[model samples]
Target chain A: MSTRWLAQPERGNRRLIRLLTWITLKLGRPVARWLLYPICLYFLLFSGRTQRISREYLQRILKRPAGWRDVFRHYHAFASTIHDRVYLLSGRHRYFDIRIEGASALHAILAQKRGCILLGSHLGSFEVLRAHGLFDQQLPITVIMHEAAASNLNAVLHSLHPEIRDHIIPPGTPDTMLAVKERLDQGEMVGILGDRVFGDEKGMTCDFLGKPRMFPEGPFLLAALLQVPVVLFFGLYQGGRQYDIHFEPLADSIHLDRVRRSETLRPWIERYVSRLEHYCRLYPYNWFNFYDLTDDARPSHTAV
Target chain B: MASSPQLGFTTASGLEQDLAKLIVDSLRLEVAPGDIDPAAPLFGDGLGLDSIDMLEIALAVSKRYAVELRSENRAALASLRALAAHIAQQRTS
Candidate 1:
């Protein structure tokens, strides 16, 4: 159940993905979405590792034994998000119904001309926000992610929307801080996923879903270092083409005295884990970290 | 529990040493307080300290100096020298 599973080359062939992306774009969303059921089944049957990981995750969330159908649904939910990414990246978001809450809080922060951090998790699709025209139309958002993790999938998506490539800030670069600082100074939002720890990335263990798991300290540290407002964002799929996105202020500014570094960071990480757990319960299948949710002190290749 | 404290002049270098001792004690760092370079970065390659360590140092500073070290105040925490300068400014104010 190690994250090593994710680091292994992605299962889908490049040509196959190219073909599927073409079909998805040409057939439109509805017909493309139908392909998810069979694709879900194919993975469920062929990929035992994914099935096992899904069952393990579902067991904890459901608080009971998870059946094959539950795992199938989990795979389907994941595939559905991938399928929908086509439309989202292409600016064809009118096909889906999206509900946004706590948008004023974001507007209020932006009104101050002080850019804030949008901290998201792997629980749901981060694309839902951008697809809704929140970027450029409402405010600018720059995504901070490791470019190498999903190079293949990213290549396809980048090809569809060439402008998005410019907004990405890859981690581990010397100028990463300068780039982010420049963007923030310009009153633009920077989004980062906070749940997983990338390889060699320093992280601390915190209680998550009644167990201890490692959460990356980098995002929180960056937020505190930058001394910007931090907001929690969740983009959830409520089945079909409907998505519910929620935003809540997590911290005004993360300040920790060296002595109380762990003490302060512990509570922040816990609060985030609790919020993630809450959504996982509401939409169990939406939580998609296909690995054992245990303490990963050593960095995972998939995390970045 | 004597209230009266001995008052003496502490030189700039002396104050820096004291601050370094505070950081070492606060973070339980392996290196000796005297080993820390005043001009070297407190983080990254200098002390090999991480973000959490920086936070711990900030907390110690706040408790001992009664001075708030915010994340935005990068100049204050850039290095031991910068931090000492910030502390001196805070004491004067």
Candidate 2:
């Protein structure tokens, strides 16, 4: 994390990206599709941060044998998938085929009026849910992302896209539970990336994509105590302006006696990891958790 | 920033244990006081606490101790040592 983009807004970066996207859209989808190359190459070459992640992920994903080329190709494909998804929403394509398989499970939980916890991972462009053509903005979708200080790219997307801005729920101060609980009480469901290590409580180590990665148990714990069902959704990119969105019921009943609370929460967390695997493996390019998911025997108990 | 030193009360360990109990009760963690080293790291992986639990823990700590625990103060949450130290330092006579 040496080169922090947190330094400056760098408006120039935004302008160039806007210009490129505009030209690509104007020039027809064929050439525009091809344009993903140089953009990906630029990021992959410059963002040593992401490249380093690609190398590590390759180790777990390609258990047998993998070379630099495989990692490079995945990065390029990832970049292209990002570009195309952006293009699809930009009206280059009218609508995508996003099929969410388990709406019944979600609807059932929402019926309780106690609120539901949509535990999501950064598996695919979550925004693709909008492309599903069934998403009603009226549905409160609060996404708890880290406090963003940098990334002009985020600023542009957030400002320009209604779908993006409408759904963002940022938590800065410590009182997240009160806020989330308030929202939940309003008969609304809030989504958080529970898979990521939020600098909160000590996190748990679980198997992810055949490797051990630490995951936060707070979301499930909250869900259980709240006595709500937790359903895992898998957003997969099926290409050609289509997505295979599937939701699986992880736990219909989460309450456990005091003796079984911790023991009970483990499987639900693995359920999250399992769904992340399905989505990430199916749409390998769209999963964006590139952080160093290593357990550094390193003391995490230290203060942040 | 830490203020003038306050000598450890014999009750400091008890206070830490009580604080840890509040944490376990609220977060439903499978941890025992013996498992929580008052001087070791608490959030990363030591106690298997996640970021969300961090927020909840702060709430529990504040609610039980009447101490204002702000997440922004990196120094205040440096580790269990720091948190226990904070709890002890701010304890009212």
Candidate 3:
């Protein structure tokens, strides 16, 4: 697929975002959340492309035609997470009830003293995991992000807790691989969003939600190169100050032999896509890929 | 930056040729080792290589030469000759 998401402009300006964040922080969550209804309605009416994309995704997962209410719910879920980030970043995580399901699996991998990859998607609130790592567990976690895509929004949000700026590693730089290697060697957890493909980076087409969708192979390749275990994480927002964070062990180690590289990587990508589909079906509104996922000029290629 | 003495060269040095072979072998490029000009860029339009190819070559170089490539030394990735020189310098230091 193409980088259509990258081309889409940031929705809101910095001043409005800063104002909203300031209000959310000062007024508390319950009072600020009252604002999301009008905001979601505004997007649902104005942002036609996002509304249509959400309806299409909901139709596929819901196995029926999605109604306006469903689309509104999806927008509300997305806005809620964005609002929660204001609190989560400011180190007020205790305000929400986050239920983590698979701690033992993560602990088992961590006990080995070898760094592991936590593969996540745009399914829900990744900030929940970051907050948990920062506050509850005291784990040194670094997030790999594409900073240029949403520069304005990121700049404003990052200013809330400037320390998070130090933990970010942007992809596609000369230092990207070396920095990841150093962190993995130090036995620190590295988080990567495996769903989105950026620029011309290589990708593999896999069956997702009963459709052939392309997923980035960069995260898996990095895991293979670093020879570390991989774990799947999803932080599903359950509405009104509740999040269900789930983690599942993906692979103890990934070894892609050069000769059969495409064949070897196929099953891993399929497994990841299948798990993502499972969660998307479980929590229908959690998926936040606001663009047409299957629309691409390139032919579907199983090989990366 | 001023044009260095190494610019505009057409042929590969001995170390550059070795690195060219390693890159061609690891990335499975169709180009012959001798055909890869030492001064030509290794990424972008020059060799038509991307960031993924850079990682593969870096891994191969680390395995073969026992030298870790750092981001601060990104200039080494400009061409075959520069990388070979960087590796050689790093080995002695």
Residue A244 error for model 3, in Å? Answer: 0.9
**Compared with the true structure, what per-residue lDDT tens digits does model 2 show for residues A1-304?**
2222211112226666566567756786667767766655555557666667767776666565556576667665555445554554554334455576888777777777877677777666555554333244434566665322244445544433556544455543334555565567677777766666644443578887767888876778777655666777656666555667676777766875557656778887877887787667667656566666575243221111
Q: What are the clashing pairs of model 3?
A: none
Residue range A176-251, candidate 1, lDDT tens digits: 5556766877888888888887655677887777788888877777676668788898999888989999998888
Note each model's CA RMSD in angstroms: 6.9, 8.4, 5.8
Computed on C-alpha atoms, the DockQ of candidate 2 is 0.11
Give the TM-score ranking, best first: 3, 1, 2
- Write down the worst ten-residue block by lDDT for model 3 chain B: B1-10
Report the candidate with higher lDDT, 1 versus 3.
3
Candidate 3: where are CA atoms >4 Å away?
A: A1-11, A148-150, A297-304, B1-12
Q: What DockQ values do the models have?
A: 0.08, 0.11, 0.38
By TM-score, how accurate is candidate 3? 0.90
Q: Best candidate per DockQ, number? A: 3
Order the candidates by DockQ, highest first: 3, 2, 1
What is the interface RMSD, in angstroms, for predicted model 1? 6.9
